[model samples]
Target: MKWAIAMVDGILNVLKPSGMTSHDVIGYLRRVLQTKKIGHSGTLDPDAAGVLPVFIGAATRLLEYSGEETKSYRVELRFGVKTDTADDSGNVIETSVVFRPEQEKLVAVLKKFTGPMMQIPPMYSAVRHEGKKLYQLARAGITIERESRPITIYKLDLVYQADDYLVLDIECSKGTFIRTLCEDIAESLGMCGTVSFLLRTRSGKFVLNDAKTLEEISKAPFDHILPIEGAVEHFPELMLTDKQALRISQGVVTSISGVAEGKYRLKTASGLFIGIGSANNGMVKADKVINPFTQM
Candidate 1:
């Protein structure tokens, strides 16, 4: 039986579908789970689809620590057009003037993007300026000056190339604009383009293959909320005695000197996930103690 309450709170791996905004999933989960403490790791465009990690209850707080986690994507580019939206959902503003490249040239182009580079965020993005979304101004047919940010592209492989469409798998940092990437790739081949399709294959270490979609969630609500410790598995693990756990749970910081300095998991003798905490000067401390959830 599904419990009305969680035993512990962390993150939920959601396979977001096209046509629904990140806010839509959060809103739905908030009501379904009946909790105000909910948040998501990243936003997938309304036209794009794939992995969106939703943090629930105490897990929402984990974002502060997991902000630097990298992501991966699979994108399809149609190399004969351009759009204001930088995606296929926008108006076709321009057509190609250059001939399509051979498969070998496309592979070489993909290789160029597999490292650090600069990317300008799309106008149809949630980036805010003067207290308004950039997309708001874009919808009004207005253009604004946006700066290009540095991003790391760990991997870029050409999955396939169709008649006019190119498919690729890329591992990049957060905040990377895939639209800009496809456009740049097109430019490298002496053409104009936009993203025809995009699906996030991975986020940090979470893969879409391991995710549960909103449609599945709606049909069969799940109470399998992972513990907060699960979210910070990438961090170092630290064991604390029951006495130390109690002290930390009551908002007390216990000092365990002669250890490495960094964030670590605070677990009890019985292996109960207390929460996440940082350590320095050999003294470990709890920054946020994930309270044990009650059974309903």
Candidate 2:
């Protein structure tokens, strides 16, 4: 039996395996679904694994509206060693004789990293310096000063600690690098460290339990496609009349009443999720619409 090749719309809670880049999953799905209009909400390093929400077809337009900006990870930091990449994957730049801190001290240090703090993006990250990616420069043996950005570690709990390594469950805002966080935490405890392992457990609504493996997706791909509206389920909704929906779909800012000034998930009277729109001063304008060409 051959699966129909068509324009596939919606999201995929892909459980990325280690050793595969997020782009690799998008590339694979493009072949499996036979379409080029695919994108991902976030990029996971090739050595990291776990939930990667993929957008397909018209859903690609809703990527920016996804509430999955905050992410959670199960990470491991191995002490006594420092790596150029801040992870075990990089060359060992420094090593030292070290001792693990007491659980109380460790917990207190973790607390310091919680809430909001400034973080310097790692040299191996995709952050751009000038016109080139930092990682690109790192590959060519160049390192430049990078401004620290504010990031919030909503939750940081120590799951376990051994003689030389510790496991942590971290929930943080976007742009928070676990590798850098690991190093910083170790530094506060008077030791050098590197992220030895990473497993993303959550990306906002997408969780590990709901994520589908590549094998599972290959067998029944459509079954794993999450509805595009799920991407913005956190947003408020506005029910529209047929005429109003038609007007909004045509890029017109339709008049609205009693709806506070904010973004909304727009639905027609028939309950079709058309797209996302913003409201202001008694008017709502469609910011993203389901492009008709993507309909299968």
Instruction: Find the candidate with the highest TM-score and give its number.
Output: 2
Worst ten in a row by lDDT for model 2 = 287-296
**TM-score of predicted structure 2:** 0.93
Evaluate residue 274 in candidate 2 and report its C-alpha lDDT on the 0 to 100 scale. 86
Residue pair clashes in candidate 1: 257-282
Predicted candidate 2 versus true structure: per-residue lDDT over 81-141, tens digit per residue: 9999998789999997789799889889998999999999999998887889899999999
Taking the tens digit of each residue's C-alpha lDDT, what string does model 1 give over 229-249? Answer: 656777877887777778777
Worst 10 residues of 1 by lDDT: 1-10
Clash totals for all candidate models:
1, 0
lDDT score for residue 296 of model 1: 16
Best by lDDT: 2
